[model samples]
Target chain A: MYLLLDQPTISQSSGNVVDGINLEDIKEFAKAFKLRRLGLGLTQTQVGQALSVTEGPAYSQSAICSALASQMLAAQLSSQQQNIFEKLDITPKSAQKIKPVLERWMKEAEERYASGQNHLTDFIGMEPSKKRKRRTSFTPQALELLNAHFERNTHPSGTEITGLAHQLGYEREVIRIWFCNKRQALKNTVRMMSKGMV
Target chain B: MYLLLDQPTISQSSGNVVDGINLEDIKEFAKAFKLRRLGLGLTQTQVGQALSVTEGPAYSQSAICSALASQMLAAQLSSQQQNIFEKLDITPKSAQKIKPVLERWMKEAEERYASGQNHLTDFIGMEPSKKRKRRTSFTPQALELLNAHFERNTHPSGTEITGLAHQLGYEREVIRIWFCNKRQALKNTVRMMSKGMV
Candidate 1:
């Protein structure tokens, strides 16, 4: 995520700001937020669950996911058009709005962690959401078929994903998410390897 | 990293390619490479080690790391300037060079896996490298302190990282890598949550 943060050259050259908020500041805080969260031994799920309890339905895991994920995603964009898309994109806007919320929540979390882990847990105050989608399980054969398709084309059209869902007897949305997640997982594995190399 | 792949709207508008390689094609191959590697039950470390043997001294885990990591990283960039930077950057160039190597290795591994896991092991063909870096370990207190600092600032610049090393009695490089791994770990955790949310 800080890949965008380290871009002093770009930011300095462009001098772009959104709603009087420096993108650089948001980028910096985001990096700090992740570091702070890990230091307290909290996963994003935990933080999301905790925030939901205090911030109401507005701060669910999906909210956290969309917010944080967008920043990380935005950092990876390398083309002018993609950069423009990011500026106008709802995802990055959502991230911008969510930044202050995350910043405050992290500060509170760090303060609690400073006091003690027990206090930190109390601060987290997990209240499980009543509704959670059941875990999707794909058969080995299904995975094999999916992998074959993925090998051939990583980005399948909506119709293609729907076709896959029909063939696999799973929901179309599930198939869509499977591809999204599969891509994210591959990126992460490479990232870990990169860090190891460094 | 197909997050960037699924973006037809953005890609069509920008239409960027590097080194005569369609970004889309590279993205697809990376996803396929990962899925194939997993299906063969080989970890990135195993693949890295295996490649080290065949690619000689020039192709260590770090080489594999830079190559594969850059493609995934390249897929994520949304800005044209950043895209140009990525192409010029050694990281992506290294990644471009290594892509074909990985593709070949994975093909052979898959053939071996189809035969048997036993045969797959033969394909891995481990040869111990004499120049492996010793792993770093941190004291609980050191971790606590480091976390404390990380909470305050994620990007501590070179001097701050150096200062941390002096205070912790570790090499500056080790401290830097720790932060890098820590950041990667946090991103992975959120990505997992995002997938679950979907």
Candidate 2:
């Protein structure tokens, strides 16, 4: 049931609907969001930073990329228009998901402004109390085990990742990300070496 | 001259050429590669693993995705056919770059086989001497400084990354990747938290 719920659906229809959400509605919201944000005198970077300090899900560029790619594929949007549309930085699915979050934030900001709290920081909510999780520190032993596993198989299956996470007493997601970063490191090394050879 | 050489050109011609490399040539090579690997009784996984051990650029999935996405966009391939064609896992640009490397490896493997070296390990060359660089270890103080900077700004410019690397005595590339991984971690945390809320 969980798997069914999580399954990704490829929308083939031309109506621009994905996951039962209207893409047209999302496009409208994206335009309105930009205008509203600008009216509040906030930059996208400022909003992103502020959201990190609040209880909202912080916007990451890759998240936007994934959502946009999937949405663009579904919507059958022209490749030429991709650059212009990217300014919105919110795809149909992500726009639908984040609509309420941004709406609430905008409402709060407006209320604060009306109440004479006009400072940029006052509405952006740079509260230090709501901090993100601290960076995970791997013990030397754990690192050894991880490196050994990586040497054996750079791409581990989900089961292998979960098993290793259990063995090392870390979150499975952390283990998965460790492999991801390790792969990126390996790629970078290969690229640098290739350049040196050139 | 270097900047001009490195600039990415968006192929506007309908001749299926990108960066002066023909897409049709890449498609042909991709098809032949699958057949050649099968003739050697090797799976794609085995080939990927073997390539990593050789003095060749390791094939990271993201590298393939980026190359493939760009190629597909240029080729204007139907989105429906993406999954079917993804098996090749090599774009025109990447195929052009890596073709010689793969061809060399294949030639050596065939030579060894003809000389009666049937062992998979012998041909794969799983030598420990050609190991990838050791994992980078960040000191506790470095971590503190990185975290402090991250709190101030999650996305740093190239100049900022170079400066930070110099200050910490790490490679600029390593610092760049640290920020990338940190952003991934933040995204994963936000995703997990959103799920928990639901």
Candidate 3:
């Protein structure tokens, strides 16, 4: 079901209301939620991590233990999760779906705070049991080669990327992402220069 | 010289001062410049466009007329020019290099404003004579095919991108950028989901 939601759509017409919920009300709620979250001295990351544990199905014990094994992955994953509020407002339907869960969580957190359970972890949950692959850093030589290829052709085939990866001694996935980032950088530069030119 | 400035450098050590100019002063100036720009009811784009005309060499009359030919390109280029302030303070040396130009331009603007020459164009120069390629919007079928390819292999070589472009009846460049944006979107989704998992 979640995977279905993840499928890309070119556009989602955001009407004034969705699922009998007013867009205006959701916008107001979003603003208020941000203020309330800040007032509690909690970050979006903390809320996201906490909500996963409390609202979702528990991962198996083995999965939880695996998450605990890599502190670096935990930190990386936590950084990635820090923008839940922004994500919620992407579409009216999504905002409507997430509102109730957030409202309930915020209320529980406030109640705990009032009752003197001030430690953030007390309400937010134990440390997140999530892991992520480490960031890839390319060598300068590899970057030069990649840039040379990009200058010639912005897109490379799966096989070509695999070949480059093998030649550069990096993961094929890393090489692929590098191309994507490189293209983005080129687009941005052109955009910036066009600004000056225009 | 400008090209040299654009060279990729892994790191630039920003100290408290550079070339007898204080970093603190530059930071304060950046803040003030933003405020002053706002006070003039000016956007960063307007300033960037204005600066290109006023501070740099005239981009040949032919180039300016070429820019005038395409209104769509002009609008696109204008949007890209926005965010000059953020770009200024990337490094202390860069900030110092640009500070004088911005300061002089602001002073001239203020003088013009005080004298009742308040029309933005009077100081900001004529509309930017810049052009950019039109944005590409992919069909649903194209996107579906692209996503399928991405799932199998995020990187597609030049030949594959050209083939897809021909198959879809779109420009090869557009198809390549589609792959790039798709990859970025996937990375962002993974990051967002990781936040939830953590």
Candidate 1: residue B6 Cα off by (Å): 20
Give the runs in model 2 whose Cα sits over 4 Å from its true position: A1-104, A108-198, B1-130, B194-198
Candidate 1, chain A: TM-score? 0.47
Residue B110 miss distance in model 3 (angstroms): 6.5
RMSD of 2: 21.3
Cα lDDT of model 2 by residue, B25-57, tens digit: 544444455566677766554565577666555
- The model with the greater DockQ, 1 or 3, is 1
Q: What is the interface RMSD of each candidate, in Å?
A: 15.7, 15.3, 14.9
Question: In CAPRI terms, where does candidate 2 land?
Answer: incorrect
Q: lDDT per prediction?
A: 0.58, 0.54, 0.52
- TM-scores of the candidates are 0.31, 0.31, 0.33
DockQ of each: 0.03, 0.03, 0.02
Candidates sorted on lDDT, descending: 1, 2, 3
Clashes of each: 18, 0, 8
Candidate with better TM-score, 2 vs 3: 3
lDDT of 1 by residue, B108-163 (tens): 77666666545455456355634444354576878888866654555569999988
Off by over 4 Å in 1: A1-198, B1-14, B81-88, B91-93, B117-119, B130-198
